[model samples]
Target chain A: MKNYFSSQFKLGILGGGQLGKMMLYDTRKYDIQTYVLDPSNEAPSKVACNHFTQGSLMDYETVLNFGRKVDVLTFEIESVNIDALETLEKEGIKVYPQPSVLRNIQDKGVQKDFYKKHNIPTASYEKYAFAKAVKESPQWLDNLPFIWKSCTGGYDGKGVSVVRTASDLDTLPEVPCIAEKMIPFKNELAVIVARNVSGEVKTYPVVEMEFHPEANQVEYVICPARIDETVAQKARDIAEKVSNAFGHVGLLAVEMFQTENDEILVNEVAPRPHNSGHYSIEGSFTNQFEQHLRAILDLPLGNTDSKVASVMVNLVGDEGYTGPVKYENIEHIMGMDGVTPHIYGKKETRPFRKMGHVTIVDHNIEKARTVAEKVKGSIKVIAQ
Target chain B: MKNYFSSQFKLGILGGGQLGKMMLYDTRKYDIQTYVLDPSNEAPSKVACNHFTQGSLMDYETVLNFGRKVDVLTFEIESVNIDALETLEKEGIKVYPQPSVLRNIQDKGVQKDFYKKHNIPTASYEKYAFAKAVKESPQWLDNLPFIWKSCTGGYDGKGVSVVRTASDLDTLPEVPCIAEKMIPFKNELAVIVARNVSGEVKTYPVVEMEFHPEANQVEYVICPARIDETVAQKARDIAEKVSNAFGHVGLLAVEMFQTENDEILVNEVAPRPHNSGHYSIEGSFTNQFEQHLRAILDLPLGNTDSKVASVMVNLVGDEGYTGPVKYENIEHIMGMDGVTPHIYGKKETRPFRKMGHVTIVDHNIEKARTVAEKVKGSIKVIAQ
Candidate 1:
């Protein structure tokens, strides 16, 4: 434990985004030296971490060289070069989530296959080399109005598409991909499970992910999802099973879809701290970032119980804004009871770029949700 | 704001004790580069801060030289030279708490007089320049028992004595101090008030301090003190008054006495993040550390509401332990729900040294209190 705190032990992280920036917060707390590698010079994580190295997380040599300077390796983003992690692991440096798990998760097709092999409940899907291959075989079009997801490097709706007709395929990038059967779901839910190397495990309460109808972006993440007790329990149990199967040594955010028929289908999983668990920061006993640190350090997992019902609204850049960013109405929102805005310290803004988030917690869940909606409507992250 | 974030803006902190260590948590969180000046190379804050400069906080030249390096200056320990802070303030560098407040608080006699002058409610006390002088003055000596406290550099239980009889004065330190008429109280309590340059102000819930009678150490600090609602409000009002008087631009932890008759008396105040507010890390909507940062930076102050009832138990060295430290049963205690231990990373252990603290949180305050007692009973920080 001493080795993990204020020592020469260095933890290398990939992707200096907001997640990385937040992760650096805990590392800084423990005085654990950290080196973060991201392509952007102005990455939000650059200032927070002890050492900020600007380089491609996907570049083979870049990651390998960065990995060599640290004791153990972990990542904030999954879109990293797995081969480099494997190389680091071979060289005796520990890489959490294991390169194997990242390899499976980095690709939609592989992640689906893993769920199937593990007998984990998930949506049925078929893999394709390209969009042309789907047209070649009409059988592949069994699910005509399906969800199209690029196998690799898909993030925040970039490599994802919804196909209403065959014509929708034209809008998607031609690459290795999966066409997931669009199962009608009553709600989107998530569970964050933390597991340490010493076998200590803890799961946060089920959180409901309410997505924007047009943008398909999660509008509010409400913890202690207002779902049936049995459904919530099942989702948590299934999430634990997935984490156990992956042998994850840190936080594993299990995103699931609650079908209208009450079946829980694994939507996807993110190996690092996920957006859905941001509510834990203000609402839960042990925040997800601190839990991630504890789990990775193999310390006993902390309690994940929420102290209050919470709703988290993401602060994304307003469309057409692309310069020094300003959070309008931030002061007004701060005046609201139980509202906390976490600015990621990103000076520049781009359309829909995640700059920060606001979490509203209250004893009454509905009140928190209402305030979150009001916050979503009033505040805007715009460029100066 | 960007200049404060990872720029060359260095914040020089005097005294690298636990409070300083915790303050560094926020500085690190905001990526505010900081330099810590303390006499001990193994100071608790030595690790977390960016730069650790070994120096005496009391020596004028030492403090002045250190103050010249940072953009803003502050201190955890009040024993720091006010002349140096005044010098720095005159030179255009910001010194939180202001030199005037420190000058008053540095001497216990002046502090008591200031309270009387302000017409603040406080226990009756007598000041003496030396222990012998108090023993010689039979007229000044009250028959009733009193608590003797040194005016300078006394921390924990050291330089403090309970004079029940004439023999008690024999062992007391011969230093300028105060002998206060002890008030019989159901509980000891404290309130932390935070203020900023923008005139923003906030107060944390009153916390009841449970003391170990034999050791004279605070065993647990329970937030939202299990007292009558009216008493809590009075304590908060008094705390706010004290903050206004100090004209401080940071956190002020006002220690107070709550009598069995439900009366409150001001004990003393620390103009920095105090131990009584540690539970904020786990329980409050906005932690005191972040609040202190916001106050100093003139950023919008966050909500100070508690999300759950929190109890903080200090981690001190067990009696007779004075060597390399080992936290026995740490894992066992951490295994319990809602138990969070913050090890300050101090490698050595001396009897009764304030090493770290554990925060237990629950929606049920009684349940959290019960767990805190168990935590206090089960763990031992001792010599290896």
Candidate 2:
């Protein structure tokens, strides 16, 4: 084994957002050398890494130059320059979760096809070169009420729309995309699996996703998704299969929908640690951040058992507020039992900007869910 | 209030070590920018901070030049340049715990006198300018069966001598020191107090320290020290007085000895986060690391309640091991319930060197203690 600690070895990371910031936590714990690159000067990861370089993550030259200085290259976001990673890989630098995995995930159209080829149970979908190409087909109206998602760069309800009618098509971008048949489901759920380079694997418990009634956004994430034992086992098995299929050497978060007919349909997959695993920080035997480190380093996988049932509530900037951010009534929420707030260090917050999150863990899942609701109602991320 | 987030505000840290690495956890959480100066290149805190400047923490010019770059300064170890901090104070840089407090606690003799001046209960002691000075004074031999501790820089049983006869004097350092009446104690205890600029305060529950008989070093730190209610309250009261007397901002850890007679005696104090509080990361409602951040940043103090009883077993290199370190049976310990290991990421293994720790938390303190003992017995930090 190489003695990398306090040595010349360096780990380079692309996309210095909250995920990268949290990942830096474990690197700090192991005293691993790390350098991060981000476009924003105030990136949350800027304060916690050995070095911070201000550059575009998608710029080929910038990423290529940064990757050359590091022993291993990894990323927090999928929208990075794969060409740069490929060049770095050719030059002998290791890229975890592999650039191939990122490539498969960057395009929803290709990701769905990869799932089909691997016999993974995913929602039925059709890929089109452009929205105009789909409109040109006379029988395209037959697939009405389907979900329309852009093949690339879709995040947090942006670059995605529901085509209820011809008029809805006017709102979507004229770019390559996917049209998927909407599956009616009783609940949304997720499972996060960690796999090391040596093939050791572990899967966290399934979590339930609760969405806002109007905004259609995830309101709270509840662990131990109130489901049958058989369903949970099935979800874990499927997630493990996905991890093995991709040969992923880090965290792979698999999101799914539990249909009314008692069938599980894969929604999508993230090659790195995902937002859904945030509850594990306070609830699990081993946190996702540390697990990522173990997986990337090919160390033995840790236990993923939950110590307590938990609920996670995202803290987004309140609509119509922007400037120096204030977490209104945060102390009141802290007064509630089992509430742990995580502020992401974003100084100026605009509407819908992700400022932080709060986790509520208790012996009883229902109690945790109730506390999560109160936390969501009491605390507001607003401009000062 | 100043918006330090993503702004020009800088926080300076002295003596970068494991404690500083843990404190950086919260500093990153709040996105507070920091600069750390340590003598060693392999300091654990070197990776997870905003700035790393290699320099002597006790050198006046080195410390002063580093202090000039930050808006506020603090430390992990007490053996820092107090005069430079005083100069920085005069020049308008805020130094937490105050240089006056460090001047008192950095030396065992002055620390004992401060306790006496404040009417705080501690072991009785007599100071001598040097070993020669003590030999010249025959009256000082009256307390022959005493513990002779060097006035400064005595850590982890080093620079400390248990004197039972005149022959012991030969092994003692020829420096100014103290001879204290050693109390036969049933257990060792500690309490961590956090105070802010506005005088807000909080104290963690007293924790019991278990020592290795042969090494005379602490092995396990058990939280919610299982002691009589009256004794616990007395310990807390003495700790509060010490914090008030010091007029310090940030964490003040007061180590104590509980005599068989149930009386409590102050041993020493660390003005920053201490090893005794490591269990807080997994057991407390508000961990000590975050509390340190809140105190120095002038934020409101958090609740100091324990979520569960926790026992932390220190992982040190086994005797006769020196080279690349490997944690043997680490996976076996990870399989146990409520066991979480924290590896410090120092790749080398020297005999008795702290490499990491394992924290076991449970509703039953006795059960957690049992698991911690098993963990200590099973894992071996050895040269690879």
Candidate 3:
């Protein structure tokens, strides 16, 4: 008579950002008891959870203390205290994605090495204990223009530099890092794979990530990617392989590059609900957030089929605005059929900050893409 | 801009039942601050809302006091204090479905009278000042068999009785009532029409109600009811007419009966989210819960078109199992594709009490209906 729904079976979530807020929607739906911890008192998920503990996720004591109080511990981000997670696992607490998986993923060097050792198709790369080593021996890069990524704490295009020239290497911070051979890829794609403790696995459809040409930031995520069926299948198979290789319990979003030769190569991975799958909220039979919970809880995985074609346009804060946030033309886009805008509840807007996103769905993929473009042009996330 | 999203502009909701819990999902998506009040401290919406207050919804002081704190107030239940709502409205607080609408709907006699006065087609019914009056003048009821309903406080299958003979009248409560002429309806149907404060209105697809032969309770609600197009259209038009007649803001669920001759007659009305529209949560582009919020907030109504066919099966507590609730065979049903169970978070389950609902969606109506049947037979809400 284990009662997870509407009982004292507490499920502690490690981060309380928009991803957690979205995940809480399913937890609330199932009446599953949830406790969330975050550094900010004003986290988007601060209100929806049954319990909210304001603490640092990186602090070993804070994470361990919180983990011991819950029956199962899962996180929305990989930046948490892995040592504390290992301790919690040793003490018989259930940690989804397992501490071992997080340990490898916590640093780019370990993640890339794991990929290489497992024969995962990723760009050939060399890891440096220090960024200065690459400068000290220019031959370490092998090529003129390599992608230099900091081994730790690189997120949302930060801590990643394109060494187009020798001076570009001088601009890089002196830290342990990896230099990946640049691939002239045609498109960036992502596949979210869900695996449970019992080993049941499922993968969502391939989604193409369209980047802002100038900023090189992902702007639109279109599901049922406008790629060849074989390519889509290849990407999904690769993602499932990654999930199996990691023995991950929960959602693992595998980002990949579709090389010019039609070959798919792994770019990186996020072991949580990813932005690329946000379209699932309105488009898929089972949303990624809910699927993540089902996987971690070992509940039966839901259907990952898309009910409609969709495109998700991220509502990054307008460059010139900062202060109280205002979603200009939000009502206008909401007037469009099948357009849903998800506001992350952040009060103030800063330049290029992730403020919210809009999902446009339609039976016709082209039509959905067109509406998504229109939504992108109309809505402006600016401060009032 | 008032900045309702993530701002101090609060939405006060009365009655924190499953309906309120479902509405809170949308509020979370929009990041709208909400405050919910319910009598029980273990209300389903308690966890999701920004603030929760424990109080009797029908109390004048409680309703008035809660109403004063928020810019806009709405109730998911019809049993709230109409007098207090009127007072609040006069004191500058906005209450959707104004107190006048509730006053008309709070009594069966008044509601029926209003339906007749508005030229709405409905079964002919004779109202009596008391049950004794009907017993005294049996000839007033031309037919021997008719439906008996209490003038006030009747909900679900309660406070209503079927009178077949003089002996049947004796079993009735001695109170003000009405006897409706039994139409021998071919099917029971419901249409949820949403109207915004700006007078814009929309009607959801007609849903057929399949009542349990023994309990006489709604067993399943099948959307896009298996009826002729013109009949469905007629039902929808009638529903829209009812919504316009009431001039109500928010959702008004219009229950109707299709006569042997295919005439659609008004059965009753609920000026809030109703059980019949529950299937829309997974079927329609805009779920009824979200539509209700949009209507109350004067936001543009979303597309009510069905993205996929769906049928909803109620998960009522099994008779003779009245204690802590347990959803037996829940995992078996969850394993089925496109099956979604919504646990209502009611810790204690009484006989025939609504514990939750399961929605089955598929491209084919017949397939969804079949899965819904399997779901009904498989999952049991029993005492642990």
User: Top model by DockQ, which number?
Assistant: 3
DockQ of candidate model 2: 0.33
**Index of the highest-TM-score prediction:** 3
Q: Put the candidates in DockQ order, highest first.
A: 3, 2, 1
Q: For model 3, how does the per-residue alpha-carbon lDDT over A172-208 read when each residue is reduced to its tens digit? A: 8889998888899999999999998789999999999
lDDT, residue B197, model 3: 89
The best-first sequence of candidates by TM-score reads 3, 1, 2
Residue lDDT tens for model 1, B1-384:
224543456888899987888776667555577889999987877755778899888899999999999888888888898888999999998888789888878787888998998888998888888776677766445564778889887766667777888777877878898888878888789999999878899999999998877677888999889989999999999999988888888899999998889888998898888888999988898889878877876777888888889999998889999987677877677777799888776778898887778999988999999999899988898877
Instruction: Provide the overall lDDT of each model, using Cα atoms, as 2-decimal numbers.
Output: 0.84, 0.85, 0.90
> Ranking under lDDT, best-scoring first?
3, 2, 1
lDDT of 1 by residue, A1-384 (tens): 334553567888898888887776577555567888999997877765768899998899999999999987899999898999999999998888789888888888989999999999998788899965677657546656788888987888778887877877877788998888888999999999999878888899999998877567788999889999999999999999999898888999999999999999998999999999998878888889888988887778888888899999988889888987777777667667788777776777898887788899999999998889889988887766
**Per-residue CA lDDT of candidate 3, range B1-384, in tens?**
335666678899999999999999999999998999899998998888888999999899999999999999999999999999999999989899788899889999999999999999999888998776787775645577888899998987888888888777777888899988878999999999999988888999999999877567899999889999999999999999888889999999999999999999998999999999998888888999989988888888999999888899988989899888889888888888799899999999988898899999888889989888899989889888
Q: Candidate 3, clashing residue pairs?
A: none
TM-score of chain A of 3: 0.98
Please report the TM-score between candidate 3 and the true structure: 0.98
Q: Write the per-residue lDDT of candidate 2 for residues B1-384, one digit (tens) a residue.
A: 544544567988897778888888877766678899999998877777878999999899999999999989999888899999999999999999899999999899999999999999898888988765666656557767778888998887777777888778877889889888888999899999999888988899999999877566779999999999999999998899999999999999999999999999999999998889999988886789888877887876776888678999988889999998787887677657678777786778898888888889887899999999899989898887
Model 3 ranges off by over 4 Å: A136-142, B139-142
**Candidate 2 global lDDT:** 0.85
